[model samples]
Target: MKSNRVALAALLGLIALPLVVREPYFQHLMIMVLLWVTIGTGWNLLAGYTGQVSFGAAAFFGVGAYTAGLLSFHLGVSAWWGLALGGVVAVLVGFPFGWIAFPLRGAYFALGSLALGEVMRQLATIWESFTQGMMGVLIMPTFLSKLPYYYIALALAAGSVLVVRLVLGSRLGYYFISIREDQDAAMSIGINTTKYKMISLSLHAFLTGTAGALYMNYMGFIDPHVVFSLHDISIMAILVGIVGGVGTVYGPAVGAFIMVALQEVFRSAGFGALEALSKAIGGGFMAGLTKYVSQAHVLAFGILVVVVIMVLPNGLVGDWRKVSRLFKRAS
Candidate 1:
């Protein structure tokens, strides 16, 4: 509990730093980081908490983006209302997805989610009349500014983290951890595995979808490729969770920071340096190194996921607990 407070304090400090520094570019990066973190927290609730490995977050994200985008474009609705409606639409979709997929366990459930996402992406492509198809929808000039977006994204991220913290500290959270450990056992002990799972997933989809609405408005554009990209869902959801330490409150944030920082570094290196670095590293070095870093940000994210899973099976916060126990023993 004390540790959690400390971690929260650190997060507050990072957010507050921008207020004093006042760099637009850095603020933009910070906005991206917070958005990913918020989405990751939502994913963590579903996969990390409920033990329902859903890879279809991109689908829900796309749904939210489109819902919000269409509403804003056609009805002249404000983003504030669009954000809420996006979440509502996502939950409506999530209920059906969860209802069908929850029957399948483990890999089967994951496969079902991946398929659902693909189907949604195709639909987004085909629905040219409403979605504007591959051309995308753009957010025109509005009363909002970058500072408003920065704070809004921060609030979303903070709200996600807070909800995760609240859940983990409650009885419902215990039910989730039990289900994750052993669904059958959780059921035998009188916990309704299905009920808990659905609740977790619904909350997960809602938060992540809301973040997507914010993302579209922030970018001032939305396209099928960008909104429904499989890569976007995987890196921001799974990879972030894996690297930061899954099922742990602060893990996703740490993973987001590391993954984003690495991307910025490699991106700043430029294409020529990237090619030279690739060649200098050779096949074996490249093969091993690629596990830790990749073109843009995805590969680096993949590597971090692998290393964390291999080295710290329980995740960063979980491992920290072990280390803390060791120190106590030594004392």
Candidate 2:
């Protein structure tokens, strides 16, 4: 009941956010956070709950984007069609791969997944006539305002959390956890380990693909390098899950908000406050200071990665009590 109240309060706050913060920049950031929430949730289901750490999330993500992009390019239909088709296409693409890859197990599976994004990227790049190669595909956006996009992204984020919650509440969730705890034991107990793992993978691919479709529609462009990126897309998904707390239902949402916010802050150099400071100084010191700060943002993020690894293994949501106690102790 306490959680329900807190959740309701949080939902209401989000619903009222756009009304209070009319700045498009802030709204865009919120939208990006929600997008990452969907992505992170998908990764959490497969890697966190199922104990299958995959590095190929970008493979499905890219399929979803291309699904939407191709529909517009060849069919001449509205890219909005991707909202329905992208996830389906992603599932279809992943189904065959899961058949082959699901049997690997452990670190070997992870290593196999590492090639997924690269393979997709190479295909998208080499097949220029179909994917337009590195030239990429662009779609004309349907809306001039960000409001509709924001609500759609909110729906996606909420839907992902809700779906994972439902699954975890069901017998399927038990099967998943059992497999995660001990795959051989689960198999010994008559649980279909491979079947359940595939189910988890499917759910993850579908959610990720749907989010990718959303990205294509919202950004109105798609390219292999951006969509199937290893560092940006795949690694960011892992960081979101880790930062939020792996295996927790709402962890990805919490992590998405923090990771997205931090990225924006560092990328913009404290949202350009440093630029103002540079202007205030107005001399040789300004350019040097700005350049170093801009370059140092990566270092700042690296430090955060280290902190999360060493201190926040349970994540913000899962480790809430520990964090609160530290504050209480300090007070």
Candidate 3:
């Protein structure tokens, strides 16, 4: 009952965010956070619950983006169609890969998924005629205002979480947890671990792919590199899952908000405030410090990740009580 109330409150807060913060730039950031919430939730479902860690999420992500873009490019169909078909295509692609790759365990499985991403990237780039060879797929965005996208993203994030919560509550979720705990033991009990893992992968692919299609509709542009990027897309998903509290529902949502906010802070050089502050203070060392801070975002991010791992290894959700205590002590 408490969980339900919390969920309701959080939803209400998100719904009211845009009304309170009307700045176009901040609205854009919220949209990005919500999008990552979907992607991160998908990643957590597979890796956190099913014990399948994929480094090739970008493969599914890219496939969805391309599916949406191709419809607009070739058939002159609206890109919105991709929201449905893109996920289907990603499942079609992920099904075979999961069937073949699930047999591999641990790091091997991770590498296999990574290889899948590389293959997809190569195909997207090498196939110039169909994909435009890195020129990217561009579509006409449907909405001029960010409001529509914001609400759509909120719906997706909430829907995905609700779906995951349902799945985790059922017998199938039990099977997934069993596989994650011990595949050999699960197989001994006749769990058909492979089958269950495939189902989990399909769910993951579907959610991630849908988010990719959303990206296409919202951004109106996508290339192999942006969608299929191993580091930017794949690794970022992993980081979101890890930092937010792996295996905890709503962990990815928290992590997504934190990470996206951090990225913007780094990318924007403290949202261009530091420079203004330095100018107001009469330059020299302060000017140099501002310049250094902008370039140091990546380094800062790396250090923060390390600290989080060491201090809150279970992630923010898993370690919430510890965090609360620390704050109490400080006060």
Worst 10-residue stretch by lDDT in candidate 3?
293-302
Residues 1-331 of candidate 1: C-alpha lDDT, one tens digit per residue? 7976787787678778678768877787888888788888888988988888888888888888888898988888876677888878988888888888898999998898888788888888888988888889897635354788888888888899989989988998999999999999999999988778889888888887898888877887988888888877744678777767788888787767766666676655442465567678777765445434445466655676677778777666657776578789999
**Most lDDT-accurate candidate:** 3
Pairs with backbone N, CA or C atoms under 3 Å apart (clashes), candidate 3: none
Q: In model 2, which regions exceed 4 Å deviation?
A: 284-286, 295-298
Candidates sorted on lDDT, descending: 3, 2, 1
User: How many collisions per candidate?
Assistant: 3, 0, 0
Residue 143 of model 3, lDDT score: 96
- Rank order by TM-score, top first? 2, 3, 1
- For model 3, how does the per-residue alpha-carbon lDDT over 158-179 read when each residue is reduced to its tens digit? 9989988998899988998999
Model 3 stretches with alpha carbons more than 4 Å out:
278-292
- How well does candidate 1 match the true structure, expressed as C-alpha RMSD? 4.7
Cα RMSD for candidate 3? Answer: 1.6
For every model shown, what is its TM-score relative to the native structure? 0.86, 0.96, 0.95
Evaluation by lDDT, superior candidate among 1 and 3: 3
Better lDDT candidate (2, 3)? 3
